[model samples]
Target: MVATAETGVRRAAGTVPRPLRGTGIGWLFVTPFVVVFAVFWAGPLLVGLGMSFTDMRSTDVRNPLGVELVGLRNYLRLFDDELMRRAAVNTLVFVVTTLPLTIGLGLAAAVALNSGIARLPAAFFRLGYYLPYVTSIIGIAVAWRFLLDPEAGPVNQLLAAVGVDGPSWLADETLALPVIIVMTAWRSFGFDMIILLAALQGIPKELYEAAEVDGAGRWARFRWVTVPMLRPALLFCTVYSSIGFTQFMEEPLVMTRGGPAGATTSASLAIYNQFGSGNFGYAGAAATVLFTVIAALAFLQFRLGRSR
Candidate 1:
């Protein structure tokens, strides 16, 4: 029955209809993604983890002695092997060499982009920076190989024009790792720059205004306001770069093939060599070790970030 306003009475309040949310259609829509992730990501990760525990060679199921559990023997090999030690050293060198350039130059570019700079310069500069990243890795490697050739290369030719002889960029063991590091930095920093560009945009206008009111000079304002604000983003980028360094494979594979007397061989690339040569057990073990290192580094960074 309808209730009059004067009565201030109504039939018992009807149950509020529960809003229908997240229908089966939602799961149906995400099913493709779920399927792909399980197949490509989860499956391989599980397989790799299992492989890490076993002496699973490509040749057989690694059941030569009926049960092939090598325990930590394979993991121990990386520390004991001279070549693996060299690779680890080379990888560290690459990381240490490239980090400043990538982070510094990336932040600088981001700042420039944030500034109301001339549009044309900004566009072209961004393109020039990012082009190397999207371009084929092999193309970069091949171009660098020729450019750094001991003779008959434009880079050396320019040096000769200036009455200076360029050192063989990737030919000398002393120079090879450094060259790879530089090239990788060049190819990579653009992505970091764009990430930082977004982070710079996210900084509130009020922060700068507040700094200005405090009579903070540009550098001081940057140090106090901008840098402190950007720390979280910077930390994330650093961690990402560090992981990439751990997985350094392409530079040595194409440019040096872990050559120049193994100066540029990284743990990842060495593991790849093992897989290619049918030593999957060794590869798996090396991968497991590298994985542990990466996981630890990642956890450390996250802890540091949380503390910050």
Candidate 2:
């Protein structure tokens, strides 16, 4: 018994358990990702955070360490900047307009697909809807530019046939932001559709059948059964869509260039402009503020989702 115990003790001391051995291998495989993430994401975030508190500028590029720390001065400047206020309002408007439209269209598409549509037709619809998302933003923007061209585009041509002159959609300050919102919604709805579709598929048909058997009409079943079952998915889509809409830069940058008196200047586009103008520290502060807003909004969304 002593020999057996000693042998077991020696084995335990020399070799890891099976579970621990597997865990060690898993961590080894994950180490490369950890290193890369730390180097690329975490490192830059720390550097940028530090930069936000300084008076760094284009001239400081050659002597970064020589830049003076300005503490909260950069952040204070953000509040008094009329352009920043405009950008904030634009971003808010964009988020409010696009979030509902995108999620609504996506939910509608997902429900249509989850219904009794034939497999082949549904597959085709899925492909058509999702195609825009996988396509390059540059290509999408170019296509939108062509389609919305005031004199030469098909939309205006159709309007002209009805004896109505279509205005320059992207160049008019009043119309530019709305047009961008529509474009963004069209490009984004497909992603939400895919997510909602997966969730819809996972829902058991039994619950739906029971609702029907209880004499619930289509709308009733949808309101009670479908909507309740889809809450989690809807929450996820809402939060994800909110964050994306808040940071939307490419659409405005490419489509309208935040033009026509900056009607379409989103927060991110404003930050990009600051960076381009070599106000690195100011840009950094703006970026940090934007990041905080995003994080707070996300947290609020998650809290609401949990409550629901």
Candidate 3:
């Protein structure tokens, strides 16, 4: 009765009123991320796209003269390079090899860990599997590089101890890429497994029980019930792993340094080398090719989702 303003009968047992400030606070909180993305991400992307049209190189900035715009010549040169072509093929093979192995093992691990069979400490087991992933990629590659040395590697030493002489893992071109593929699979699958395990837990157990009551065997139940429920998470892991495998550079760069005979140079590694070789224009063109390939892969994933 004595209030001037904003004084109504206090709510005794009713819902609290929402903030009249609306989304102002929310937008304010998100502004930092927006600004950072615009400056760092969008700014660099635009600059790189512009650099692609010019002869920008490591030493290009030292001179005051502006870079010359060579139109489509740089792009044409990339297509005409036989080494680039081989690099593309090698990259494709690596991706194809890495995706199935990583994603498949992840799915298997997720199922086991999420199932009733997980009697051990799941965190310890999960952390153990994830250890390699958390370890430095460069450090791991360096360690493995020594571990796969042609004449004096521990892997071969163990084989020699077992009366089976193992061939050089890194020096042998035939085995080098395969070894990297396996190493990458082992390191990456743990992340996917942890994510997929969380998704598996979200699925209702009643569905599985109902599935069991329907006379479905283990394999049948997994195929129809578990797999169907897991498709979304599976697709996510597949697309992520595919993109990662496709753009792999660190492994081959550190381990093989592009090969015993250029057998392990991924497209990313090639592009990186292009910069060092003062082929900035050509590198940009190849960068677009990688972007296009990744975009196509992402689009295909959407198509798969729609089909499902």
Candidate 4:
């Protein structure tokens, strides 16, 4: 009787009760992305993982079932390979060197852009800085090669005019990796600048005003107010740059071909070289190791960020 009375009251109030349905509408909106992810990402990852355990070659493509499962032998081989160790070292060097320069330069540029710049000029500078990020990396590498050419290139020409003879930049193992690092840092920092710039604009002006009123100098204000507030953005940039740099391949592949005595061969480039040389199982093993390292580093970064 009470329930009937409530239903009558609800009707009188122009409210109607409906049966609870499943989340069909929500799934309707999400199904496309789920399908795409399954087909592209999940499927390939499983295939690659399985391939790493088998002694599969490109020649076995016609009879994939005949390829022998080698267990962990392919992975074990990586430890004994001298070139693989060299590539691992080179990758580590690239990530460590490029990450700091990219982040520091980007943060500086973002602060410059956000501080007292007029709207029109700020927009112009923002676009200019961001162009390299959107530009094709291959094209950037090619242009960098031309500019750093020891002969006839404008950079070397200027050096010659100043009575300094330019050495073969890309041909020297000592110089090739450094040259690649500079190119990569210059090309990538603009992306970080844009991210940090957005974060800067979101910061409240009242915070700065308060710091100034407290007699905080510019450095004190930045170190205290700005750095603390930008922690999340900084964390994101660090993880993203770490992941991207771990897979560093294009710069070395295009600019130096990992040449001058394998000095610039990153782990990704090594994987590509192995695959090209028909060692598909070995390449798969290398790729799996690289993926594991990337995952571990990213997790560590997140853990450190969370602890702080």
Give TM-scores for every candidate, taking all chains together and pairing residue i with residue i.
0.86, 0.91, 0.87, 0.90
Candidates in descending lDDT order: 2, 4, 3, 1
Q: Write the per-residue lDDT of candidate 2 for residues 1-308, one digit (tens) a residue.
A: 22335689899978865663555787888999999999999898877888899989978999887899999999999999999999999999999999999999999999999998999999999999988889888899899899989988999999999999999999999999999999888988999999999989988989989988999999999899889888888888898889889999999999988887999999999999999999999999999999999999988887777765
Q: After superposition, which runs of candidate 2 have C-alpha atoms over 4 Å from their true positions?
A: 1-26
lDDT of each: 0.81, 0.91, 0.82, 0.90
Residues 40-93 of candidate 3 have per-residue lDDT tens digits of 988877777777777777777677266788888877888889879878988999
lDDT at 52 for candidate 4? 90
Model 4: clashing residue pairs? none
The CA root-mean-square deviation of candidate 4, after full C-alpha superposition on the true structure, stands at 8.5
Please list all clashing residue pairs in model 1, or write none if there are none: none
Best by lDDT: 2
Number of clashes recorded per candidate? 0, 0, 0, 0
- Local accuracy of candidate 1 as per-residue lDDT tens digits, 240-285: 8888877889878999899877788898988898898877767887
Q: Which lDDT value does model 4 have at 249? A: 96
> For residues 1-308, could you state the per-residue lDDT of candidate 4 as single tens digits?
22335679888668644437666866888999999999998887877888899999999889999899999999999999999999999999999999999999899999999889899999998888888888997888878889888886789999999999988899998999999998888888999999899889889999999999999999999999999988878888999999999999999999989988999999999999999998888888899899999999988888788788
Local error of candidate 3 at 121, Å?
3.8
Off by over 4 Å in 4: 1-21
